[model samples]
Target: MTVPPPPWRRAPSPRKRAEKPLLSPELVVRTALDILAAEGIRAVSMRRVAQQLETGPASLYAYVSNKEELDELMLDAVLGEIPCPEPDPEHWDEQVKEQVRRQVRAMMTYPGIAKVAWNTPIPVTPNALRQGEAMLAFLRAGGLDRKQAAFAGDALSMYAKAFAYEASGWTFGEYDPAHMAERERRMADYVQSLPAGAFPNLARIGQFFNAGTSADRMEFALETFVAGLRAVVRA
Candidate 1:
């Protein structure tokens, strides 16, 4: 005899089955960023992201045209995290510096974004535009003409992004203490082993190759950049 209908079929149960979350642009970019944070940018493939979201890769194509689109979306999404402050005419330079710091801090949150920033043009997304505009406003408020402001803004932004990229060290896999020690050893050896006569300068300071803490270097860089930009302003 046929068994009574299974429970699920017997009464389409009062509770409806839980529906799976549908894929969206936000989810795809977010998932990709999470992967980029844990792994390198190369590790964030559509298939991999799809797997993370428990869906098929085809579903992501509807949101992102391809991996390039996905990368741009990821960049824009991260850029949105950087807070854009009001430009104070009285202390525009300081505000600009603060913006650079905020940018570097934000980029550092995602492990490999610094490298991505180098090749990818600045995204013209909503938040990214706001950030750029605020920076330009600061430069203009600090007595820079349109051209000077544009040039200085671009330079400051590039400097911040490049600094963050170098700091990340993800490209060289230096997160491990052992790897870093090996790198420092090789660097010191090569620098010290160089022919002293030909390379007097590097040889003399070779012992100080890995000298300062990262914070020290970053502070020096920020101060020097602002100083140089001020030179252009005064000139």
Candidate 2:
């Protein structure tokens, strides 16, 4: 007989070959969101996510059709966490700002979720639609017409998403507090070293650069934007 396959070439153990449970789209999306939260968005992929679930890429197809769909799912999932407040005309400005703040906080916690949030189409998820309705309601209660309310909501949301995305991008890799401080010092020095006359504002404010806490920046931005909204409403 042809030299039989060596004993060392035996097939895998039968126990190890058992079929895995059917993978669902929800499972894939949840695992992907976890991966995105733990690692950066770059760490999320069909192959990697499938590996996390102990399955093959082919199996994931039974649920998520493609990367785009998975991204949409993750974004909607993130949006789901934001609680929609009842429209309170007396506190609509504060309410809307708080909602945006909460959303930004949630997105920042998940690292790359901000990027996904930016380009994801108008989400059709129940939570997302409900949020939109609530936002429009709040704006309208604050005296905006339907079209103005819709546009203002979209513009403010875009700003929040972009701000959070940039903030997340800055903290992507292994972050060390000491190292970050050193880097900030270097940046401040660089700015300060610029020709003082040519860059008076930057040189003068070098000490202020990267000096504020995330909360401080968020509050400042919120106040400024809301003040602008008040002006718009009054106009």
Candidate 3:
């Protein structure tokens, strides 16, 4: 017995191909961070990261379970950049303020980075927990009660993140081009132009409102916070 061939059988056509690079957790994270830096959080997604890596989002799942996990890792990566200094009770207020300065400086290095961290439960990640421990240790050394030490630590860390988040708003290029100086000028002008009788208080001190550079403003705030903590803890 012999098989017969169909009269109109056609050969299959080739389909489009996609680049498939070897995937790894670090590579995936690094690519996602690159997107975060080049674009912004809004532009990041599993698919977007995969596309950058010449693969599919499904591949990313092997590393980060979801976007939430990715966000955590991203935050941890940033926190890892900060160094935890030794706790010194002798000058606890000064030591704590120095740590605040370092943390704030670190947060400011990456645009929109604080958004991933602010208000999130104290991170259980290694570097983040180390920060928490260091903050609490210094505060306790300053003679504060356990409750006070915890509150002080949270307050300082949150304030730094909040400050960085707000600053990032104006520095994100296309979103808002007005730097702090431009904003200062605008506010001063607006206040000066206001009808004098209605805003007498604002009119008098309007010129002094936004007088300093970013670093100067941060220093002023950090000093005030540290001073307040010193008074509160009676250290």
Candidate 4:
């Protein structure tokens, strides 16, 4: 029979492992956002987040339902950064423009997040709902009736999402001034080269193709949309 080691010669006991913090929805969202910021949205997934959290993927399900729900939560979190101002009756149009600008800016912070906003059919998340309500208030202050305000709000949301998505495509890394200039020059040349008889308007107006910056175009669009609303106001 083998003899046991003496007390002092005995091997040291295993130390108790440190406990991990409990999982929560907020933590999961934050982790996902972190992943999104580091590597574009495509890098974020339930399994990826769970790996980061040092837990099983099933553990994340208890907090976030699925990747789609996670995306919705992320979009809501981005929108929450935009401040909702009190509807100013006199400056309602300006307020609308400012809010839309803020929304675009917020979405631009994380690459590809704007596409989520664009694809989401009906976002019932808290921040998304708040943004919609605030937009309606602004539209109403501009003298739009209930139905008018509702339709305008929907249109404005679509515009903002589309704008953000497009801007992000250029903003993320593809924005090159010299390249854009060369491309525009080529486009203008191609348009002008077309037979005037076949494309009269395009050949004639092609000279104005590169006249304005994106910012200028956005401002003009906003002005046109807000000004057009006055015509639709209750008679």
Winning candidate number (lDDT):
4
TM-score of each candidate structure, all chains considered together: 0.83, 0.81, 0.78, 0.79
Winning model by TM-score: 1
Q: Report the CA-based lDDT of candidate 2 relative to the real structure.
A: 0.82
In angstroms, how far off is 232's CA in candidate 4? 2.8
Q: Give the TM-score ranking, best first.
A: 1, 2, 4, 3
Which residue pairs in candidate 4 have backbone atoms (N, alpha carbon, C) closer than 3 angstroms, thus clashing? none
Candidate numbers sorted by lDDT from highest down: 4, 2, 1, 3
Clashing pairs in 3: none
TM-score of 4: 0.79
Whichever of 3 and 4 has more TM-score, that candidate is 4
What does candidate 2's lDDT look like per residue over 154-208, in tens digits?
9878878987887887665635668888987898788777775877776675444
- Total backbone clashes of candidate 2, pairs 3 or more residues apart or in separate chains: 0
Model 1 has a clash total of 0
lDDT of 3 by residue, 1-235 (tens): 8866576877567876866667877788778888887777767789999889877789789888999888878777777878877878898888888888777766667666788887467689877898889889899998889999888888998888887777665555624444656886887789888787888886787545442566677788888987888888765
Q: 1 or 2: which has the higher TM-score?
A: 1
lDDT (10s digit) by residue, model 1, range 163-187: 8887776443646668778987797
TM-score of 1: 0.83
Where is model 2 more than 4 Å wrong at Cα?
1-22, 174-190
